[model samples]
Target chain A: MLKINNLSATVDDGNKTILEALSLEVPAGEVHAIMGPNGAGKSTLSYVLTGRDGYDVTSGDVTLDGDDLLEMDPEERAAKGMFLSFQYPLEIPGVPTMTFLKTALNAQRRARGEEEMAAPEFLKKARALAKELKMKPEMLKRPLNVGFSGGEKKRMEIFQMMMLEPRFILMDETDSGLDVDALRIVADGVNKLRSPDRGMLIITHYQRLLDYIVPDRVHVLSGGKIAASGDADFAKKLEAEGYDAYAA
Target chain B: MTHMPLKLENLPTRRDEAWKWTDVRGRVSETSAGLSVAGLPKFTLPDGITVSEVETDDLDTDSAMAKLARNFGGKVWAVSVPEGFSSDTPLIIEGLNRGHIRIRIDIAKGASLSVIEHHAGDAGGFVNVDMTVTLKAEAKFDRTIVHNDPADCVRIATAHITAWNDAAVTQHALSFGGALSRIETRLAGMGKHIEATLNGAYLLDDKRHCDMTSYIDLAVPDCTIRQAVKGVVTDKSRGVFQGKFHVRRPAQHTDAEMRHDALMLSDTSEIRSKPELEIYADDVACAHGNTIGQLDESALFYMRQRGIPLAEARALLTEAFVADVFDDLDDEDLRESLLGKIREWLKEG
Candidate 1:
């Protein structure tokens, strides 16, 4: 469902190249994990895919469901079923969490020529999801991610992902700031949303997250390219050792 | 000795330190005809309130614009609230559409009142208003000014407020600019343990201009003062904010803070802000903050990435930035009305 061919990118016209001729594909009904160390361009790959600024693609072709994703703006890509769970979720002051969710949902629906959800229906679904995610309902009333704990923010991300219900999901360093318990809860939420028609890319440096939501395929990213590909066991072996050999 | 009809020479110029940024003298033509004596404003009073004309000759003031208002305006319209009078409904003051006008409002001891001054005075004419409000001991006064004028008019409205011991004073003003418009407020804390809050917001579009200037004095001990003003300037519009908090030596427990924040949306749009705190009391806590810049790009990108269009995202962020000033307003309906006006302003162009 998601394909990348010969992706070569730079840091916005800079001399340094962050992504080499890297190529990877995740088919429908599967979850893939990209494991890399610091400076391995793990986050850069997610940002480039989601059409964030400050990154220039020198030569690459990315397609989602056979549609050219690179040509679309960030919002357009979002409306086309692309979702990025940011490594560090921003604190958008004055925008209530529930209101933001409703807006995002409606905007995507509007873009896709679907009817907007009514307030009562949206509230009912949101309240149920908040309970299942173990998030306090009151947190939804506060400004989006403002004054929320690290665990709460990660949970909120999962909450948003569930609300938007995108076809392609990019989980960028989702476990960076989460504790063990929060990691379990977040992983459980992701596991419940897994389906045969959706594709998931989990980007992380450690194998701890894979223990909860195991990936179908694991790729070792080194020097901005896929150095190795193996089954989910690869993640356990790399965790025992380290990225030292891959860093070379 | 001053003449009957005030000439344009009586207006303050850019050379004057107070009107440096807002130059009425330069904007008004020198060869234009002088201003004549004008009548009082139309008032929609609540129960137990009446208006009477008092001679303006008894009023003496330093402000050049106020002096012009007193001299050209024939009399001061007076409105008094009886002792211990508290009302759930606000007293509405309207029809401040033209000419020079002066008003004096007195709140008796232990009384509470709310005043809504609606200014839609955007005719091709010039308007000058001088208003004074005095609060007796332990009185509570809430004043809200909603002003919107188009690009063809010039307006200057100034208010002088005095609060006695243990009195509570709250003022909130929202303005959409005229050709050249200014809402100036000067508040004095006259007794012990008084609390005062002065907050305002302005949204200027096109070639409209609006200036919100306030001076607060904490003259007595144990008085607390808070002031915050937020503004947004779009297209070729200009928004100005000047706020100062003065704490005297005798006001030992004085706690005052002033904040002025503005957002410039277009390349040609302009925003000028000055927030000052002058404290002579060694034991007092006084602070001031001022910022003039565009909206946060990171925040904008975040919102857009969530599927909101760029323009909608910008409007939402701008609304939130300007909506913070009215968070403490006691009247929920009035607060929502102000926010609705802000949203309407954002939706236009």
Candidate 2:
């Protein structure tokens, strides 16, 4: 389970508050979606949850599986099964995709007191995952996201999620630059990882992504707070009617 | 002039324009011990090549270090490659540990040769070397310099090269710095249609210092030159790069580009880069670029978010930043070996 209670955050060295008294919860085996318009503090919430620097949490409490998530470093949070698929994936030149994957996986495993995966076994698992995602084997040999297209970067993020197998996943605008076919492929990859032991928090601006990956609950975030909450049908209502009614 | 043992005062100080960044006189003293004053370096010559000693005190350059080598080094070892001669194996020169050494290489017309020179010195020693290379028409020369000196050694190595028309020259250098070290090269092209490439990389740590300087003179038309150098410094260490391309008025069709990029890992680490292009011809294409920066923060965060630790993330990013300098090497084993050294340095940092 993941919980955020009265979470308020200030960005740019506390010059301005982006998240204000925000409260939410996502239980295991459930998928929750947060829908909001521009300047609704949607991305800031995700960044705060993942422990990115430069975001000061003035007053709030965030926990995963009853453990304090706010006190841990970003890597520690990641090792504790917190994953955030960035809205704009960064380009890391010179680090091969395969090498990056291995380093990430081994680090997480070591942090959890598990033995490192064997080379052959790791390669076998990676090759199988790449095949399932319809990614070329040669793509794994290139530098990580150095020259990859938007769609390819999204797919690579999902590929990493599958390989890491985190307990909680946060997808931040994963469908922004993807096309219809590419969106479908990314959706398929995400849906395959859904299980009763994992929790997911999907943040999107449009209901189009909801059509492919249905959510159990939906919340309308406005002015750094949740103005309304309902079932999946609420997403359709928000889509039909703009956020003007929910504005703070 | 009489032949006398060179004194410590003969070193250049920061007052010299060319040695401003690398002050050899400011660091060494008369009481510096463990000075290895030895004879010439051992060379493993391949077939079609011969080495003979010649007594010579006529140095060509005005460089302070080269003059020290000329005055201290009694004779110069001349290595000659006959006309139309070619070899599959590379001639290897053992590491220069101490003393002053002078060498000259001559590649006759239509001849080709490759040389690998290693520089590793003893503790508290000051090593100086002066080398000259002459290439005739259609001659090909490939030179690789590898420097891994002791942490307390002060060393300087200079090479002067002359190439004729239709000659091809390639030089690659990798240096793991010492207390204070400098590798300098001067190339003069005398004919048209010549091709030259100069690429190098340096890694420094633990207060070590290294300076890589090169000056290319293109005096004729239809000459092309390319130079790129990458450097990484950590733990209060310093790295320097000085590159210049001088194109004369007669070299109308000349094309040249020079670039120097460096990465500073620690706040205390320093890097000085200067890339210059002095072109007298208006129709030529010449460009120079220099950059000194830290690793990308966004890229570092991305790697860490994937569960890599801070140190490992930094190492991976740095290794990538300097890996492209050796991309054009023809030997796979040699490339891997060079990468191995980089990886080792990254781990230690």
Give the fraction of reference interface contacts each candidate recovers: 0.60, 0.79
DockQ, in order, for the candidates? 0.70, 0.83
Q: lDDT scores for all predictions?
A: 0.88, 0.89
Top lDDT hit: 2
What are the clashing pairs of model 1? none
User: Candidate 1 has what TM-score?
Assistant: 0.96
Q: Any residue pairs clashing in model 2, and if so which?
A: none
Give candidate 2 regions above 4 Å deviation: B1-3, B33-39
- Per residue, candidate 2 scores C-alpha lDDT tens digits across A183-233 of 898899899888999999999999999988899999999999999998999
- The sequence of per-residue lDDT tens digits that candidate 2 reaches over residues B19-80 is 88899988776654422243468889997789998898688797887787777766898999
Worst 10 residues of 1 chain B by lDDT: B30-39
Model 2 score (lDDT): 0.89
